[model samples]
Target: MAASVIELSDVSVVRDGNTILDSLSWQVADDQRWVILGPNGAGKTTLLQVASASIHPSHGSAEVLGSKLGAVDVFELRPRIGFASTAMARRIPRDETVLNSVMTAAYSVTGRWNEEYENLDVRRAQRVLAEWKLSALEDRKFGDLSDGEQKRVQIARAVMTDPELLLLDEPAASLDLGAREELLQLLSGYASAPSAPAIVMVTHHVEEIPAGFTHALLLADGAITAQGPVDEVITAENLGETFGLNLSVTRENGRFAARAA
Candidate 1:
């Protein structure tokens, strides 16, 4: 069996006396690509935070990349994990160049702040840009790019470090049809590659899940309603339960769509 990338045992997180995650237990293997689906306030983002080591569970055992949370230094552990989210994107300077935005991830900083990078780093960043189809925009300022371009940039930066685990918080959110499909194609390619790291993406819409994702976890009210192989866990029954609405789900050409039943 593949090594476990994340292991959460009876984990619970409480904030302001409200339970965010209630005794949740789950595991993600290094070879798996998982998509988390849930409605608003379902604690999906919070779960990603635990996997990223950005937050420790208020109770229960949480381990990421073989290191136990609260026992290991998060700063060191975080470099081995790639995280891309709107929160992280906001920290990036608007004036920063695309190449610099990605290169600074080598040091885990938001912007290029006098931190020196090696020749190898520059080459690697350039290569990543090319791989993500952003080579033409390398010199462009991050703020000047379209939402699609910026989303791709964020993902490129996340993978720049060659992290062991990649966590994306709604990578396709707010994108137009063209942009969303473009990003999904790139994500599917990456997720299907043998060298790709274990990935977990949180999104509210089933349409955003890229091909090659192997597993699914449906969360509701801070708990797992269903989880396992993507094919089995993403059924209409599961979707309906998670979202509190009767939903019909369909799959075609390795993609999924859901609608009200």
Candidate 2:
């Protein structure tokens, strides 16, 4: 069997006397692509934070890559997990060039500098940018790019280190129809790559799910509504329970779409 990349057992998170996540258990095996669907404030982001080792669960145990939280070096663990979110984007210097933005991820730096990088590292960064179709934007400042372009650049940066896990928070949130479609295509390509890492993407819209995602977890009221293989867990009944609305979900070409029943 493939090793489990992420395991959470009865995990819960509380903040300021309020419970944000109730006891939850989940396991993600190596090479699985998961989609986390939830309404706002359902703790989807919190779950990703735990998986990325950015936040510890307030109760129970969380294990990532055979290392349990509170028992391992988080700094070392963090470099092996790629994370991209709007919150993270706001922290990066807007004036930094696209290439520098990706290169800084290797060192977890925020901005460009005069320091030198190894020739191989530079080439690797360029290669990722090219793969993401951002080679032309290498010289462009991050602040000057469109929202879609920024998102692609951020994804490239996230993968710059060849992480074992990749977490994407709402990668399609601010995109227009054309941009969203383009991004989905890129994401689909990545999802099908044999060398791609395990992936978890958080999104409210079912349309944002890529073509090759294999599993799903739906959250509501800080609890899991349903979770398992995508074809079984993403039914209308489960989605309706998760979101508190009647929803009819359909799959086409390995992609999902939902509508009111």
Candidate 3:
């Protein structure tokens, strides 16, 4: 069996006496692709943060790659876990070139510096950019790129370090139909790759799910409503409960779609 990459046992996140995540238990094994579906304020981003080691749960145990939270060096563990989010995107220097932005990820830094990177590091950055179809925009300023381009660049930057786990928070948010489709195709390719890392993506729209995702977790009110294999967990019954609405789900060519019943 594949090793577990992420594990949570009765994890809870409390803020000002309110629970953001309540006794959430989950496990993501190596090479598995997972989708986190939830409504606004459902703790999707919070779960991603815990997986990335950016946040510690207020209670319960959380582990990533055999390193338990609160008992390991997070700095050393961070590079092994890639994370991309809209909030982090806004923190990046817009004036920085896209290539430079990706290169800096190897060192977990943002913005330009006078330091020289090794040849291999530069090559890796370029390779990641090519993987994301952003090679043509390498010289463009990150701020000048279109939303879709920027999103791709950010993803390239996140994976430049060859992380064992990749967490994407709303990768398809704010994209137009064409751009979303393009991004979904790119994600599908990545997810299907034999060497792809374990992936967990948080998204509200079922249409944003890529073709190769294998499992799913549905959250509502800071708790898990359903979780299991994609076909079993991403049904109309589970989604309706998670989103508090009548939803009909359909699958085609390994991708998922949903509509009001």
Best by TM-score: 1
Comparison by lDDT, 1 against 3, better one: 1
lDDT of each: 0.96, 0.93, 0.93
Which residue pairs in candidate 2 collide? Answer: none
What would you estimate as the lDDT of candidate 2?
A: 0.93
Return the lDDT, model 1, position 189: 98
Highest lDDT: give the candidate number.
1
Clash count, one per candidate: 0, 0, 0
Give a tens-digit lDDT track for model 1, residues 96-165.
Answer: 9999999999998988988888999999999999999999999999999999999999999999999999
Q: What is the lDDT of residue 151 in candidate 1?
A: 95
Per residue, candidate 3 scores C-alpha lDDT tens digits across 1-261 of 799999999999999999999999999999799999999999999999999999999999999999999999999999898898998899789999999999999778888687779999989999999999988988999999989888898899889988899999999899998989999999999999989999999999998989989999999999999998998999999999999899888988988889999
- 1 or 2, which is superior by lDDT? 1
Query: Can you give the lDDT of residue 232 in candidate 1?
Result: 98
| Per-residue lDDT value at 152 in model 1 | 96
- List the candidates' TM-scores in order: 0.99, 0.98, 0.98
lDDT of 3: 0.93
Instruction: Put down candidate 2 lDDT per residue, 1-261, tens digits, no spaces.
Output: 677999999999999988899999999988899999999999999999999999999999999988999999999899999999998888779999999999999888868677678998889999999999999999999999999999998899999999999999999998999989999999999988989999999999888989889999999989999999988988999999998899888888888899998
